[model samples]
Target chain A: MNAIGLVAFALVGSAKAIRAEFDLFGVTVVGLVTAFAGGATRDVLVGRVPLALQNVGEVALGLLGVCLAVVLYAWLEAPDDRPITLYADAIGLAAFATAGAIVAIEIGLPAFGVVAIATINAVGGGAFADLLLDRSPFILFEDFYASCAVLGGSAYWLFTALAADATLAAAACATVTVGTRVLALSRGWTVPTAQRLEAVTGE
Target chain B: MNAIGLVAFALVGSAKAIRAEFDLFGVTVVGLVTAFAGGATRDVLVGRVPLALQNVGEVALGLLGVCLAVVLYAWLEAPDDRPITLYADAIGLAAFATAGAIVAIEIGLPAFGVVAIATINAVGGGAFADLLLDRSPFILFEDFYASCAVLGGSAYWLFTALAADATLAAAACATVTVGTRVLALSRGWTVPTAQRLEAVTGE
Candidate 1:
C-alpha cells in the first residue's frame, strides 16, 4: 500500500494542469482522487461494498498519497516541474496497472477482461479527475499512456502463459509499463494517429 | 427507466428558477447530472467494471431523464421551484440507493457492509456533484435522503433473512423511506437546531 501510494501520488501530480495554479490543497485532492478513486471505483463496480470500508490500510494509503504529493511538490519547487511530475505519473501508472490486473485476476475475470479492467482501473480515475479539473487527459494529449498500459498487460499475459504464474506476470507487466512509458516520452515516440482529427473538429 | 424519467421531467418542469431563464442545454445538463451521475458514481465506487462498460441502458435512462426534464420544464412552467428540485433529489437518492444495495447484495457483501455501501453510493455522487457545482448536498439539509437509503438496505437485509419471504419488509422499507422524505418536506420538519448558526454569513 505504501509503495502504491507513492506511485499514485506521482500519477496524479503528473496529470494536473500545472498552469491551473493549483494550491497544495488542490494537488493533494487530485492525488487522493487518482489513487483511491480507482480502487474505490473498482470496488463499487464489482459490488465488493468498497474494500476500503473494510481495509483501514487502503484508507491510510489514500491519505498517504495526498501527504506525499504535498511533500514531493515542496521538495521539487523549481524552474521546471515537468520532470518531477512525469516520473511520479509513470510510477503511479505502473503500480496501478499491475494492481488492477492482479485484482481482476483474483476476482476470476477472464484474461481479456483482466487486461481491460487493469488498463482502465490504472488510468480511469486520473482521466476522470483531470476531466473534472478541466484539463485534457495526458493520455489523450501527448503521452503514449494507454499504449504502454496495453503493452504491459500484454507482457503480463505472455509471461503468465509461459510460466502459468501470477507473480512473474505482475512484475514483468509493471516493469514493461514503466520502461515503455519512459522510452515513449524520452523518444517522443507515439502510436500513429489512427483517429481522424481534421474530420473531428470543424471550423 | 421511463417512469423514472417522467418523474425527473416533472421535477424539472416544476422548477420556476430553471424555466425562468436557463436554456434547454443547461436544464438538460442539470437533469442528466442529477439522474445519471448517482448511478455512474455508484458503479465507479464498487469496481463494477462490467456495470460501467456494458450498462448502456443506464446511459439511455439518463438521456430519458434529461429529456423528461426538458419537456417538463417547457410544459408545466410552475412557480416556487423548490418542491420540484426536492422531488428530483429524492428520486436520485432512491434510485442510486437501490442500485448500490442491489449491487452489494449481488456481490455477496454482508448486511452491514451492504447498508454502508448503499448509503454512500446513494449520497456520495450528489454530494460530489454539489461540491463540484458549489452547492450543499440535499442530504445534509433536508429530507430523509441518507436515512431512507440505509433503511431500504436494512429492509433488503431483513428480507433475505426471512428466506425471501415477500413480506411487508421491502414495501414497508420503501414506504418508510419515501414517506419520511415527503413528510419531512411537507411539514417543513427539520433536524433540531439549537446553536447551529455561526457568526459569519453562510456559516
Candidate 2:
C-alpha cells in the first residue's frame, strides 16, 4: 500500500512539475517531496521519524515513479491532465488516507485527530506541490478532493466505534475515499465557495 | 522566548493576510498557523505534542499578536512594509531557530538534523503562510532568510562541540541569526538565484 501511494504520488507530482516547465532537477525534487511529504508529516504529527528516511526501498520506489513520469511525459508530450494520472492520484489518496487512519487509531488519537491526520496524509503532498508551483492549494478552495478523505476518515471512525474488524474498517475507508474521488472526477463535483454561497443567497 | 516568537509571527502573518484581502476568519487562521506551525513542526520532529496545543498561554499570545496586527493595520492603513514589523520578524526567526536547535541537541540529533530542524522551525511558518496566500515560499527562491538559521544552527553545533555551556550556545545561536538577518535587511542583501548566476556568468 505504501509503495503504491509513493509511486503514484511521485508520478502525479512529477507530471505537475513537467507541466510547469521546471528543470529535471526541479521535477525530481518535487516528485520526491510529493511522494514522501504526506507520510513524513503524518509520522511527525504522531511523533516518529519519517518512514521515508528509515526505508531505502521507499526512496527507490519514489524515484521509479519519477522516472516513469519523465518517460511517459516524453512519450505523450502532456500527461498531466490525462485520465491515467488522475486515476492513479485517486488510488494514492485512498491508500494514504487509510494508512494514516490506521496509524492514528493505533496511536490512540481522538476521533478528530484521526480524521484530521487522515485528511492531511491524503492531501498534504498535493498541497505542498501546489505551493511549490506557486499556486493556492486546490484542497483549500478549488477541489472536491479532500472531502473524500474526510468522509472516509469519518467512516473509519464510525466502524471502529461500532467494534468492526480492523481489516473491514480499513477496506471500508479506502473504498469510500476512492469511490467518492472517482465519482467526483467523472461528475465534475466541487465544493461551494463563499462567493458561490453569497450568489446563491442573492445577498 | 516562545511567547515573543509566537506573538511576532502571528502579527506578521496576520498583516500578510490583511494585505492579501482575506476576510477576518482567514486572517485569524493565517495568523495562528504562522505563529504555531514552526514550533509545532519542531516538536513533532522531536516526538512531542506541540506546545501551542498543550498550553493555553501560547494560544493567547498568538491571538494577541493577531489582534494587534488587525488594529495596527486599521490605524496605519499599510504597515506590512514598516521597519517595526521587520525587526519583530527577525527576532521571531532567531527565537524559533535557537529553540529548535536546543531541542535537537537535547534529543541527541546529528549535526545535519540539528541544522535542518532549526531552519525548518524558523521559516516553516512563513513558508506555510505564503502557501495560504497563493505564492511560492520566499525561503525557497528568495531572501537571505533561511540561511541565517542555517548559519546559526551550525554555530550552535560548533559551540556545543567545543563543550560550551548550553545557555551560552543558545545565546550565540540567537545572536548570530538575528544579527545576520538585521544586517541583511538593512543592506538589502538577497540570495542569488539561477537566473542571477546565469546573468553574471553571461551564459
Candidate 3:
C-alpha cells in the first residue's frame, strides 16, 4: 500500500515537472522528493528517523514510477495527460494523509498535531516540487486539495478515537480525501476566496 | 550558540514574511518553521528524532525571535533593515551548516552526505519561507550562499578526517561560511548564469 502511494506521488511530481518544462534530471529529482518528503517530514515532526531513508525498496519503486512518467510524457500530450495525473495525485494524497494520520495517532500527538502533520505530509511533496520549479504551490491556491486532506485526517482521528477498527478508519480517511478531490476536479468545485469590500464615498 | 543560530533563522524567516507583507500570525508561523526545520531534517535523515519536537524551550525561543523581528520590522524601514537581516541570515546559515556537518560526521555519513546535509540544513528553512511566499528561492539564484556552506561543510569534514579537535573544526566551518558569504554580499558578487548561451547561436 505504501509502495502504491509512493509510485502515485512520484507520477504526480513527474507531471508537475513536465508541466514546468524541467529537464529529465529535474523531473527525476522532483519525483523522488515528492514521494519521499511527506513521510520524512512526518517522521521528523514525531521524533523518528524517516523510513524513506532506510527503505531502499520504496526509493527504487518511486524512481521506477518517474521512469514510467517520462515514458508517458513522451507518448502523450496535454489533454491526454491531465486526467491520469489528476487521478494519481488524488490517490497519492489520500493514501499519504491516511498513513500520516495513523503515525500521528501512534505517536500520541495532540489533535492539532494529527491534522497538521497529516495535511502537511499529504501536500509537502507537491509543495516542495512547486517551490523548486519557482511556482506557487498547488495547495495554497487549488480546489479542495489540502482541505480534503484535513477533512480525511480529522475523520480518521475521530473514528480511531471512537474505537473503530484500524482498517475501517483508514478506509474512511482515504475515501473522504479521494472522493472529495475527485468530485471537485470533475465538477470544477472550488473553495471560496475573500472578496474586496467596496468603498463607500459620502454621497 | 545553537540558540543564537535558531533565533537568527527565525529572524530571517520573519524578515521574509515582512517583505512579503504577511500578517503577524503568518510571520510567527514562518519564523518558527524556518528556525527549526533544518535540524529536524538532518535528524530525520540521520535516524534520530528531531530535537525541535522534543524541546519546548526551542519553540519558545523561536517564537521570541519572531517577536523580535516584528519589532525590528516595525521600527526600521527597508534600507535600515537590509544589513541586519543579511548579517543575521549569514550567521544562521553558517551555524546550521556547521552543526549539520558535525552530525553527519558523527553518524559516519560519506563526505558527500556531510556537504549535502549541511547545505540543505542551512538553506532549507529560508527556501521554504520563500516558497510559501511565492518567491523564487534565494539559493537557486543567489551569490556565494550555498557555495559557502558547501565549502564550510567540506572544510569541516576534512578537518575532522584529519583528527582535528571538534571545536576547531566547527570554528573552521563557521568562519569559511560566514566570511565567504559576507565578502560576497559586500562585494556584490553574483553567480554566473546561462545568459551567454543565448548569444552562441552561430558558434
Report interface Cα RMSD per prediction.
10.8, 5.2, 6.0
In candidate 2, stretches whose alpha carbon ends up further than 4 angstroms from where it belongs are B1-32, B51-127, B136-203
The sequence of per-residue lDDT tens digits that candidate 1 reaches over residues A91-115 is 6778877877777777777678677
How well does candidate 3 score on lDDT at residue A193? Answer: 25
lDDT of 3 at B8: 78
Candidate 1 lDDT over B5-60, as tens digits, reads 33453344324226545566655555555545555565555554534346677657
TM-score (chain A) of candidate 1? 0.75
Model 1 reproduces what portion of true contacts? 0.13
lDDT of residue A37 for candidate 3: 85
Model 3 segments beyond 4 Å from truth?
Answer: A1-101, A108-116, A122-134, A138-203, B21-29, B68-73, B78-80, B192-203
Ranking by DockQ: 2, 3, 1
State the displacement of the C-alpha of residue B52, model 3, in Å, after optimal TM-score superposition.
Answer: 3.1
Docking class of 2: incorrect
Highest TM-score, which number? 2
Worst 10 residues of 2 chain B by lDDT: B20-29
Segments of candidate 1 deviating more than 4 angstroms: A1-7, A10-30, A41-47, A67-82, A107-111, A134-136, A195-203, B1-203
